[model samples]
Target: DSIRVGDSLTSADRPVSEPISTPPLAPPTLSCLFGANNGPLVGQEGSIVTSSKIRARLISETDNNVTLTVESCIEDAEKTLVFGRGELQLGILIEQMRREGYEIIISPPAVVTNICPDTGKKTEPYEEVVVDVDAEYSGSVIDSLTGARKGVLVEMMDDASDGKTRLLFEIPSRGLLGFHSDIATVTRGTAVVHHCYLDDREYAGALGSKLERGKLVSCELGKATLFALASIAERGTLFVEPGDMVYPGMIIGEYNKVTGGDLEVNPVRAKATTNIRTVLKEEKAYLPPPKRLTVEELIGYMNDDEIIEVTPKSVRLRKVELDSGARERAARVKKKRLQAQMQKKK
Candidate 1:
């Protein structure tokens, strides 16, 4: 196959035009970390996993699992670096890792910012979002996105073929972080959402989290009882139903927005019975359906001080420190540190 029959082989030191600018070596725009409570991954200490678009190095083997980092880098083609790109890919990676008998506490994904070379301004990657929903639900979707997510509406059109409304917008990649479930809730699970990277733009300016509510954590470990769930349901929504296993520091539900701040409660309290008979009959209690979260939704729902515990058998959400006293102390310290930083910025 080598240059047969005097056919001249076109060879050069380099390409004349550099071939489509080589895609400009995509910038690292997203990140996640190990939980603050994890220690050495059992025996896999000092191990690292990397791929074409992501790199996770076991930065520390210390028992206190804090100070973790991520970098999107192109490496071996066979490795999957897709964890930072698509939620489906991320879910797949977690599933695969858990099935391999590897369990770890992973934090929620956060967006990484960069300085725009031209304007010398802080910039973060933007995403082009397309949402198709029933015409009746379009208003709710738009209100949710524009309210606190800082999304800019680009176009709104109605699909002639399906009678659904197509809403397009440009939103910060960070804004899309855990918005899938919210959209589903608003649209009654009739919405289809998709996003793709556009380009970096001037910082959208920090915005309050649309998901600013706190979580309902368990105070004890045991199988949830209907009596305990009834009490929990009164506070807000319940994530676990009767008979589900729960542990201390594990998130059992989202606290009511009105009654904000993380609240610890018992999820396994047994119903009390007495020999005394009351004249009035106790009413039969109907338990509401538990709000089940998929892996992607769980990631979106996790707080910075929280992590998702992955295992082949279960996926659980828990605070960094399993001990309530330690977790509160850590939260206070983090709060104070953040306040100090904010003061310095001011």
Candidate 2:
């Protein structure tokens, strides 16, 4: 009274919800667009546990999340750009993913611009930026936004008597890459910035004005000495103090002066002394405590020629052209190109 046909049973078939004896087959393909796992606190607390566990979760995610489409990219086999919201949203997702166990390397957020084949004009995506901050901080925000080529101010309204103000501007995506930290600092952590993409338009002139200030770089590699830091403290704010390990070209602090210049101050030098037997205890080193930069601050402070090297444990700023000789050559080439452009304009 029963017919056997391959794996299918014929009692004329069973209900859809009823159990079948055969095991399910695996899907043909699965992949993921991984993001960065930066900051010192990542792996210390979370489920999923190891990096491999994170990878497994991502692959499994593809099975359940219907919206994501994964594919291989030639730029780096280990990296994939999950094309979705801007870096901020993607960053939040990456943070959450890392909390769940995946260790991924994320590049700086860049706009994927399009070229008009007909007119050969370069285009970039724009954004609508909304800012809620104290009234006093409005000027700096306006100046910084304008400098970045953010479009006209659409509105400025006062928020309820907490002495807060709300400002809105249509900004280009390129202009907003590192703007969040600057807004926060300027408002003393009281400002909130919300932005979403607008439209793709002509490229903005440049977006580095907000990060134009120069940085204090370490001229040598060693543990920072208190004596040297005390002497160098007058030139600028200190980023590292005594006993902190520093590497050459490492950005230690920001200079106070507006005009850009690199100061060669070695923080690891030891004091020389003669063996005169004086019974006084060693003088307490009076060094100013250094400022520790957060991840947002570090990103906000880097220039176009530099990059923020992030790891699970640390964030380091380095020249995009890492080697000294290569950096110098690149600088020269850039300078020459600028000079030629200026000459052409004249």
Candidate 3:
């Protein structure tokens, strides 16, 4: 309450109210951080992918951008945590960084958890999402939110004349990660989504994993050859084309179904040159162009062992280990560790 410009108010024996100080502006807690992009192609595309350069760049980001903050990891200086408003804001930063010729590896969006001051319990962020979809897509949207995302249905209203529906949901923040792509898929690009911070609540169990099919990883490094890609394409879809540059542990394509799992194939293998010529005409192989992923999509599709290699000239996906044998060994080690943990729990 404030006094009028020309009027003065006086009180006798007034009880003083407790002083309320404005809270200092705190940095946003990172939903995920971009890890080191230390792939084989690290320095080729960007001039600033090193620890020092990345740190400098990230620190500078906070100067102009109010939605995000940067901090170095105590365990590894090469890795930095970038706290931001959400994936969309972070994705824009990644794109800008790449354009500036910085090569980096981005990690999947990490879920942020906090300690509730009052209850002394772990808390996680939640969101209020509102979606408008065509009548035909309304059911699927509801199912995805309530079933897969653990969202609470707040309200649903149908527009009979226009054949569209308005839906509201209170969903865990982590559940909304990568959901824009799914919403596009389900609604045939006819849906609109708006979300804002709701509140923090006790942490929930796992919402679920990305529903993407397994990817095709390359086993060799070189320019892909039509002779080799044609053979590999039969197993599933091809993401790389002939003459495309590929490296060991690079993701080349995706399997047709989720059950197919990951498979390693040679993207650079070429047919042996021989003196013998075929008597009959050979059919020319036609291969589809490789899939191009946006910064958000790339981050969304990446697995734990994978990272997005961002460079000014190129964007690639590669395994952390790089070598096929090393990756397999790492996978085995991880599996054993998980099994041990499970046994301990039991």
Question: What TM-score does candidate 2 get on C-alpha atoms?
Answer: 0.68
Model 2 regions more than 4 Å off: 1-109, 116-120, 159-163, 207-211, 279-283, 321-323, 344-346
The reply for model 3, stretches above 4 Å from the true place, is 1-30, 209-212
lDDT per model vs. reference? 0.70, 0.62, 0.79
For each of the candidates, the C-alpha root-mean-square deviation to the true structure, in angstroms, is 8.4, 9.3, 6.3
Q: Report the lDDT tens digits of candidate 3 across residue range 265-344.
A: 88887777788888888778877776777778766667778877878887777777777777778879988999999999
Model 1: which residue pairs collide?
A: none
For candidate 3, report its TM-score: 0.88
What lDDT tens digits, residue by residue, belong to model 1 across residues 269-336? 99788999989988666789988777888877787788777655567787777798998788799889
Winning model by lDDT = 3
Which candidate wins on TM-score?
3
TM-score of each: 0.73, 0.68, 0.88
Model 2 lDDT, residue 77, Cα: 55
- Candidate 1: segments with Cα more than 4 A from true spot: 1-28, 34-83, 160-162, 209-211, 257-259, 271-286, 334-346
Residue range 1-346, candidate 2, lDDT tens digits: 2332225543646445553575532121112244343323344434333434445555555564433334445675554545444544444445556454444544444556778787789877777889888888988888878775566688999867788888989877667666776677777888788876667678776655443556777767778887888778888898877877666666677777776755556788888878787888978667667787654455435565655544444455654443456767887999999999999999
Alpha carbon lDDT at 113, candidate 3 = 81
Which is the better candidate, 1 or 2, if ranked by lDDT? 1
